[model samples]
Target: MMTSKIIEYANNLIKLTDEEAEQLSNAFKEVNIKKRQFIVQPNFTAKNRYYVLKGTLMAYVVTDEGHNHTITFAIDDWWITDYNSYIFQQPATMFIVALEDTIVLQIDHEKEHDLKKSNHKFETFFRIMAERGLASHQRRIISNLTQSAEERYENYASKYPQIVQRVPQYALASYLGMTTEFLSRIRNKRVAKKS
Candidate 1:
């Protein structure tokens, strides 16, 4: 029997009947990814959907200057993917990598399409997920445009307290649009003030 906890979690975002949960459990595959593992690589069309069960993942876009710019980070209970490539069957420009040893539940494109077709609620669930992703991207753009590096760091610290310690300063610095030196200075300042 499936646990009610999993059922409740699924139901919160999408209505899943008992039979549907059983089908979903059968369709989904669980993976254990080591830190630095690539979830989605560039030039590949991402064919799988992943639901993070533990740890953190970073999505980044490599620039012409050869820098890998952090696009976003996904922690526990979040989803990570190269959205445009996954949805439209296009080549991926972004790379999704595990920032820590992680566990995830994955369903490939074929299985996901079948699951959505099998239930209207599943389609609605994915629609909501897409909307949420777009909103998050928009907020990131606004923050990058209007917020200072210190402010962005503070926002990230408050919003994702769990990730602050787990993620490296270099990755966090990229996310905050600041140099590692700047992040180091900020951390040093904070430490000195607290002492």
Candidate 2:
């Protein structure tokens, strides 16, 4: 079911015949990444977009202050890339790394272009992903600007419970733009509320 994850993702936006699914899946090359490995580094061009088949990958950047900020994470059935760099063929300012030993299906620019040209459904699927990414980023910006820390954490927990389980708390805290100690307090408050 290596392809099943992507096939299912594709079908969510646009229904495809089995034959089309197979064709779309064929564009990917399987890659295995070791824990702590860097997939794409700052100042390098990101060659491919990866679909997570198992384990996790993170996209992050180190600030001038020498602190890492988590930009995004991808788990099973999710997509991960230094997206702006990949799309525009520019050098990446972010890093993409394997958080755990991982399996992924990767597609290069040529293959992606070919796949999209071959199937309108593929084009629609990617368009939807782009639109959703934009919407999610907008919501996150609004949440950070307006929501209290507790409210933000609760909203994220409800929306992406799987991320809370799969990612380290410190990384999640960074992604939430909070201190780890603050996140710890939030977690404690959440536990107290549940009880």
Cα error, residue 173 of model 2, in Å, equals 0.8
Residue 33, model 2: lDDT of: 100
Cα lDDT over the full model 2: 0.90
Stretches off by above 4 angstroms in model 1 are: 1-6
Model 1 worst lDDT run, 10 consecutive residues: 1-10
Candidate with maximal lDDT: 2
lDDT of 1 by residue, 6-84 (tens): 4565788887878987877777788899999998998999999888778889999988999878888888778888888
Q: Model 1: how far is 111 from its true place, Å?
A: 1.2
The alpha-carbon RMSD values of the candidates against the true structure, listed in the order shown, are 1.9, 1.4
User: How do the predictions measure up, each by TM-score?
Assistant: 0.92, 0.94
Q: Which candidate number maximizes TM-score?
A: 2
